[model samples]
Target: MAKSTSGLSRKRMGEMYRTMLRIRRFEETADDMYMAGKVVGGVHVSIGQEACSAGVCAALREDDAVLTTHRGHGHSIAKGTRLPEMLAELMGKVTGLCRSKGGSMHIADVSKGHYGAHSIVGANMPMAAGIGLAYQLEGKDRVAVVFFGDGASNNGAFHEAMNLCAIWKLPVVFFCENNQYAVSVPAEYSTSVDDISVRSKGYDAPGLTVDGMDVAAVYEASREAVAHARRGLGPSLVEAKTYRFFGHSRGDPHYGMYRTKEEWEGWKGRDPLIVCEKMLKMTAKQKKAHADAVETEIREAIEFAENSPEPEESVALEDIFA
Candidate 1:
């Protein structure tokens, strides 16, 4: 492994590797649970793209706000949400975040500064701007980070929010996890631009593209973006070129449906976990021990979620305003 030019401490690099491993293991467990019918509804696992969430969130402070899309379990975990509660929420149990109302798509922990994950396409972009506005009005140094997909980047909301954020000099970072496909459609077919970061030019903000499979690359880019926002330099766009190992959702037959096995294997070859492990120069034994520790933690989370009681049927109507 070459010496890290990113200047990250050995401890921090190890921590990043552990964090990515946790996200990978958690999503793998969730996929198994979903297949076994334990987790109801659909789940959008961020399997291969864990580095984006973990690296970006690593650059954020505890008080910094984050808004993510439906495929957000990784982002939630990276942003400091409790694993057990998040799993319980996915299971629709009473002990879950939002008391089981939000389910997988809407998991949130305001205390952790994660506003919530949205199911609507591109909905949170403007909301992130609003959160940044609130922080600005409050005269705080906090910044808002919004994660969206390549598909959402084409939506009007993304453009509108970026314009607003740029004009107002709002402290926000628009992190686009461009995993190639917007559901069944590839970015090549759906998007006009090669890199989503190019859209920032129209809004008069800085734009950067990073190799999302490299955790160190993502962390460095995010650190710069976060610093730019915190310094009141306004918003910036970071487009992470990555891939999702799973289907658009758990139900989709990812292979041969829209993508090929060869393509899948190509991305898997660049798996962030593998990349980081090589960078850290972890021995086989050390890798196994690290993986074992993450597995144990995930097992505990699964147990906690299983042991939790289901939400009462009647209470579903209670939390609703309409």
Candidate 2:
């Protein structure tokens, strides 16, 4: 993408573009694997919402913590989680992030400062707040970032976490990836507010909304939000108005049933990758080069997962608490 004059450097913009492309390709490969019976369990792909995760995570430090929702593969990838391990986890291989136990929804890589991806809606919000509290007590400048959907914004956990984070002046950023759907229900039908960021006001926290499809916009907003938190100014909420180009999950067959074909086409026309390509004025050769590199990486990851051995059956009960 074209480097914003005052914001991201050209190199950083290039990194963002590559990161977004990697997320898109990774999800696409995972979808194909799921359909071919290689990947088991529920698979939620953030195909169209890559920019939000890429931009937000790009603005964070390596030691900063992050909590993500069920649809968090892109988030983990953006936060430095390895693609091979993530894909292996989805395929139930022993080489997976959680030794194939967490599947698609529960991948966690604490080494990268990614707390974990939770399957439960709105569950990670409070967990992120607790992480923030810990950082505060330890006198660290680290910040906690939580990624949730518009649906989760209406959940009680979201309300409670926002209140506590604000009250304690905890360094946290509540990033609501408003993809406009809570499963089959539309946000317009489910949420009373037009913008999810408005809810931040009730907690006395700063709130802002950005065009999630635009990576630069997201990056700018997130940088400011993260900086505010790092300065010990408390929490902020960023509502990214974006769209998912697929069904809520792989198992959900009603992909285009709820929304109109025109709506889908309109959003796809603004595909984040395409937009970034335009901004960068990338040539066909450059685009092909980028695509080829990402495809090779993804193919190698899949091969690694397929070649990895499964966990021994004897160890199945080892991690259980019961």
Candidate 3:
């Protein structure tokens, strides 16, 4: 795991690595809990695609906003959502980020700038467009990023949102986490566009693609794209072509039922954590120490989430509207 020392500070690089590791471990823990029948509902783990989330999020300001997909925990974690609250939301606890109402698909912390995660494909793109519009009208420089899959790129909202964002020069970044599939369907089947990034031109926006497995590459790409939007240069589309080592949700096996064995093995070999570790000039002991500390922190968060009480029966009737 070699650190891209070109343009990042020590603290920034370290934070990026830490965020990637956090996302990886969080999804791993969620997977284990789901298998043990502790976690409820469906979870779209972003195991193999952590670099896309961490890289892009690393470039965002605290005030910038983001919208996520069902496989959104990575973005939430990267955007600074506290783990205990997130886990509690997954467990349906009263203190959960979404107050135990949104569950896995809808878990969001508005205060953290994570607008919300939706299960409906391509639904959030338009919402993100509207949010960007609000920011522009309010005279705020803040930008919004939308995380979606390749299948979502084909949806009508994707086109409509991009059109609106480009028309008004809204500060938005369309981040397509092209993890090769939309659930069980492959991108090849869903799209005729050779590259998702090229589709950005249709909306008169800049489009770029990066190695989604490489966190450094993603961070660099997003930094520039976000900077462009912040300069009021209009929007950009980034296609992070990564892979998923897990199923669409917790119930499916990692071994691909729809994909080939060779494809899975190929992507697994380039594990983001391994790549990051190799780049850093640290001894195995130091690497282990860092990983252990993070694991301990996550363990504590999980414990807190588990011990926390579930939502009160009376809460079921509250927070339904503004």
Candidate lDDT scores, in order, read 0.91, 0.90, 0.87
Candidates' RMSD to native? 2.1, 2.2, 2.1
lDDT of 2 by residue, 76-183 (tens): 999999999999999999889999888999989999999999999999999999999999999989999999999999999999999999999999999999999999
Question: Taking the tens digit of each residue's C-alpha lDDT, what string does model 3 give over 138-216?
Answer: 9979999999999999999999999999999999999998988888888998898868999988988889888888888
Model 3: residues >4 Å from true position, as ranges? 1-5
Worst lDDT run of 10 residues, candidate 2, spans 1-10
Choose the strongest candidate by lDDT: 1
- For model 1, name the residue pairs that clash: none
Off by over 4 Å in 2: 1-6, 253-255
Give me candidate 3's TM-score against the actual structure.
Answer: 0.96
**How many steric clashes between backbone atoms does each model show?**
0, 0, 7
